[model samples]
Target: MKRYFIILAVLLTGCTKQLTQTNPNQQTAQTFWKTATDAVDGVNSVYGSLMLDGSYMRFTHVVLNTRGDDATSNSPWDQIYNCGKFALNVDGFAASAPFTAYYQGVFRANQVIESVPPIVMDTALKNRVLGQAYFLRGLYYFHLADIYQNVPMPLTIAQSSSDYYARQVSQDTVWMQVISDFTKAATLLPVSYADVTGLDANQFGRATKGAALAYLGKTLLFTKQYAAAAAQFQAVINLGVYSLVPNYHDNFTEQDENNPESIFEVQFSRSVGGTTQGWGPGDPQSNWAKYEARAITFGPRNFAYCDVQPTKALYYEFLQEPTAANQVDPRLYATMFYNTPTMKVYGQSFQATFGVADSEVFCRKYENDGFVASEFVWQFASGINSRLMRYADVLLMYAECLNEEGNTAQAYPYIQQVRARVGLADLATVKPNLTQAQMRDQIAHERFLEFGLEGKRFDDIRRWGWLQDPTKLAWLQARDPEFKTYTTGREYMPIPLAEIEANPGVIQNKGW
Candidate 1:
């Protein structure tokens, strides 16, 4: 039987009792915290929430993807704008499993935070535990603010016996709190874990000070605190702990699964034999297997569905047409596989790549290993870690911040570093002659190409204030006219109706 972890109550009750592993000598918290190892394990449980709980995946998909102007489909989530029923509606932003999952993640993180301090331990160990909790708590709130502008921010545990109702905090307060947590986490976490040293090890996937700093910078940029954000990103550069993995493909290759560029990653270990498979169960498993460039886990016919093909807008960004040929940015081919004539796959010719005969326009190259079966069989196997944050992002963000502060000279080199790694040409000379708008566009484009579909795209579009730009929106629609008619009202997602109805304090985003 699969073990379903109940993470919600941990948030509501602020209780770690449920998270405590069993002990032979004592069945109590006191007995459990007899050593630093025990405390570390408890902290790991907090991070574990990213895995078992569905919040991370759902929030990235429905909440983030829906709010951004990037998509066109009426993906059930389209109701955030179309229906104007912010408080309650099902297909259109009404509450459902996903909303609940977000809260559950917050709850579990809070539980860890609440429980850790009380346990007596060495100061260093205690700080580490507390730091991880704060990191996770901030992460959850970051997502919350990104979606529901003003959301209830609960720092402590909520007990069922206590007041079940709490009010929402302003979005500004939420961002402030997020910054505080990430800053503290950056100070406390090690540059990297000891076991996973070097690009070859899986350690890069684990959270480090660099990852926290990168996120802190991201949050700052999203809020338009450009100068401050740039400094934080620069700090990562100063650490000298990471660098871009040369080939765009190396970043996602099985050999470089957790390369130096990755500041943090979601660790997924493959399941070899029996039910204890590393990648999770069934469909997610099959999807993992099929997407890999290696041999199909379930053969070609039984492959996983829901491939998350890129939109035509994204495809055009690559400019991989007959005239374009290799002219399309090389990164485009590295980031996404084109069924077009130039970059054919699986014996499928390019002429029919996106034509009616073959619907595979652009599949995620990062997700698809393109590894053929062989001694490379291990590459197709599970255990491939997803790079959540990378040094490249840090460099680009720093460049953006510098550009915003009119320090284009300082910024240009950083952007050039990333381009050079990918065998692309650097930006033009960056002196006082450069325009902020031009540099801004460079950073935005860099982010789009670098972080596509890794849960960063929509956030980038939304924060850029280009969410409602008619031209950009029109481009999205041009790729799929179904989106051309979408309204600006979707700027904020509807509060899932169930959540609004359940929590009186929660207000729906206006016009939702």
Candidate 2:
């Protein structure tokens, strides 16, 4: 051993520089958050998670939209089909993918929140960075609370082995933390990035004050604090930073993303960032391209595998109300591609390429049919952004808050504003003086048509308690056969079995 040690020291005698070298490409917790760029990069990493497979990249929207009566999945994969049918394969990729993706977001956000503050940087820039961190953590938890309904709550980054396994908290406790984060974010964030002075200056997708307030409102609404929710939403409206884009379809495309209507959306690019299609929680700065797989999953047929499609009920829902011109609603044309006269898919006649079968509907909302001739062109590398919130939704939610507060009449103008955009007859003229219950039904009808296949219907129905109400559940089952399989307490996706097995403190959701 002594002889070998002497020889080894002699062999490295002239390699002292190599022995002392540190890998500049590698960044660890201890070395990160040392500069303004480092802080910006940290927050950017939190945003990066939204593009991963488990997050909005694929599974999140797929399961969220498909579980509702408005959409159905016909994939060959049983796990995909199961999620839409309200029978989530708790241990499978469909369930676990999003579970891990969201926590990955939470973990990155934790790092930003814990590490960025101590760095010396421009005061305003530092605040913006921290504000985004809080907003993102809140946003991730908002989805976590709604989708899983109950999960662990960790506000700070783990510093020790014991810190890694956060004990599960009740749904309400998670909501409270979410509320706190959003509240802090609202205070620290600017209304828009237009005036921002740092790395995110004038950026379109990073969280803004309005975005934070909107989520705060949504979280409040989700938790049934109607009055509090109303205030936050009103604050967003008061910010005066957002408005509905005249062309509704503009809200769904890569070309028109982050428009005035889009309050918050995940940024994606085909040629930038990680471009790989693998679904693991790999490094954010790795080669997994900043692209979303959802377009392929929901893309129109003939060009891509149309795993998901709009339910017939959704197709007919738009038909139930003709435009003021006594013609088919234009919004319907923008939302989906079904066989119709003179209708076109990717500039090809809808009836010519696919025979007139009204029952078969494929989503057109997020596809590149308008930009590229074929979805096959992009395939898995879809650069289309995933819109998480929009001002149009805010208007609808605010109206809901008002009606729930017994101010039914005041809710009229808000819903009416959304209707007038599409040339629908004003509600005051078509259905005047609606009672509270009548207005409630009217908003449900409006939201049904306005936000189809936007990953919002399930949350809408759940919050309205439609799934638990036997009469309402029967109504849903009548429109979607998948709803027939829905049973009590299964409204929320099951907590992943892997989570339960890995953490002794965690328990499965009730129905599973």
Local distance difference test, each candidate: 0.58, 0.84
| Candidate 1 local lDDT, 19-103, one digit each (tens) | 7556687445446655666666666655544553234322234344333333223223333233221233532322343444455
* Regions of candidate 2 where Cα sits further than 4 Å from its true position: 1-25
Q: Give the Cα-based TM-score of candidate 2 against the true structure.
A: 0.94
Q: How many clashing pairs in candidate 1?
A: 17
lDDT of 2 at 101: 77
Point out where model 1 deviates above 4 Å.
1-34, 56-98, 195-204, 272-303, 320-328, 341-360, 368-383, 429-433, 468-472, 479-482
Candidate 1 lDDT trough over 10 residues, lowest sum: 293-302
Could you tell me the lDDT of residue 177 within candidate 1?
A: 94
Q: What digit string (tens of lDDT, one per residue) describes model 2 on residues 1-512?
A: 00111012113333434545567997767887799999998898888778767788888888789998889988888878888787767777777777777787887898899898899999899998999999998988888889888798877765555665677898899899999999999999898888767787887788888988999999999888999999999999988878888988888888887898989898887877654665656554466677888887888788778889999999999999898999888889889998878788898998888877645888998888867888788778888888899898999999999999999889989998899889899888889988888988999999989999999999999999998788998999999999988887788888777678767778898888
RMSD of each: 6.4, 7.1
